[model samples]
Target chain A: MARYSILVTSSPFTSNGGANALAYCQQLVRDNHTIDQVFFYQDGVFHANAFMHPPSDEPNSVKQWVAFHEQTNTPLVVCITAAARRGVLSQQEAEELGYNAYNLLPPFSQTGLSDFFTKLHDSDNLVQF
Target chain B: MATITVRMTTPPYQGISAQDGLDFAMAATNYGHEVQILFEGEGVAQLAGQLTPPTGMKSHTKRLKALPFFDIEELYYCTQSAQARLTDGQSLAVAAEPLSADGVKELMNSSDHIVTF
Candidate 1:
């Protein structure tokens, strides 16, 4: 199985961009490939929110991602800068937002943009959304 | 010794870029080349079981399922994207992962060449 790292830089609901990112990773898993990591940046950071509740008419994107991580045991990393900029704060986000600290959590870890490059260096393939 | 990676950025029922990427990857495998496909951005819809293509367009979701038979084993989707769509692991017909951006970069580094559509 090939190891892959995918980067998503689009909004969760804007233009259905996030949906496309999910397809790439799922197809790899179907082929018995390994997903090394997923980094959510830019507006993509909103994806880490578990509190998101979309209407019945609209599908819940955040929930779908949470389940995907739970099943694959793959790590999801959100950029601190992006999260803060977008106002996506975990419990730590309160402090970060107040003191300007970075707070990202489980299923969604906090990291630097440089980490994205590091992961890319180690992956068999890398794709950006 | 040669590994090819295909990146998808279009959503289902919106455009043919994702389907074209998948089809091209399959064709590469058929041509005796190694291939890997990654769906980023809106391209994740190619795996959405709820997809309903408009008239005249083909079903990309079905075409994507045929990758394994062609030995196009490496398929990847952005984890954040999946979360955005509310698509779970079980929801996908194939075995898949929620790949992180970092992982995707590394995967690209391993490839000899990459293509995005």
Candidate 2:
């Protein structure tokens, strides 16, 4: 099975890219393919925002991503530069930046682009959305 | 190290995709991977010569010109896309080769990984 590294570069609500990436990941899991990582960059960092609250009936893309991570044990990495620029900060990052609050959700860690390249080097394929 | 191709389809300055794609390409090269950048669709605008960004906008042309310094020498643009968008007398700022559809297919097929922006 091919190893895949996924890149999400669009906002979760503004576009369906995040949801579509999740579906692709699910299909990969069903096919027994290995997922090396799901790297979020640019506006895609919004996928890890813990403060997002949609209507109860609406689909929560962040929650769905977290669930996918749980099911597949795949790493969800958000680019720290992009996340910080968009206010999607982890507790440590918020503290470092002197923000009183942080919104980066669990199961999603903030990292540099170097980490993404390292993972991409190890993967057989890279899929972007 | 892997041979990676980053295919850009977004126009420059309008969104962060163009900048992000260039940044990713540089980062990949820094990590000792082979990187090729392909500009297609609206992305071909990124290589247009004599681009002048509005006040407060970063100069994409300058950044693109510095790609060779980062050791990313393989640059390609879709010939059809450029012909459709660029009027007569317009030219590319960077020294990128024009690729037909088949050439683009070969580039993607030969790369170990393909990333689109």
**lDDT: which candidate is best?**
2
**Model 1 TM-score on chain A:** 0.86
lDDT tens string, model 2, A28-53?
99999999999999899999999999
Candidate 2 structure lDDT: 0.90
lDDT of 1 by residue, B33-83 (tens): 678877787777666775677888887767777778999877888877777
C-alpha lDDT (0 to 100) for residue A4 of candidate 2: 91
Off by over 4 Å in 2: none
**DockQ of structure 1:** 0.03
Stretches off by above 4 angstroms in model 1 are: A99-105, B1-117
Alpha carbon lDDT at B38, candidate 2: 94
Candidate 1 residue-wise lDDT, A1-129, digit = tens: 788888776777776678888887888888998888888866678888766778888877777777788888888888776677667776676774576543345778887655654555567766667
Native-to-model Cα distance after best TM-score fit, residue A52 in candidate 2, in Å:
0.9
lDDT tens digits, residues B1-117, model 2?
899899989888886889888898999999889999999999998888787887787899999988998999999999999988877667779889989999999999999888888
Q: Go through the candidates in order and give each one's C-alpha lDDT.
A: 0.73, 0.90
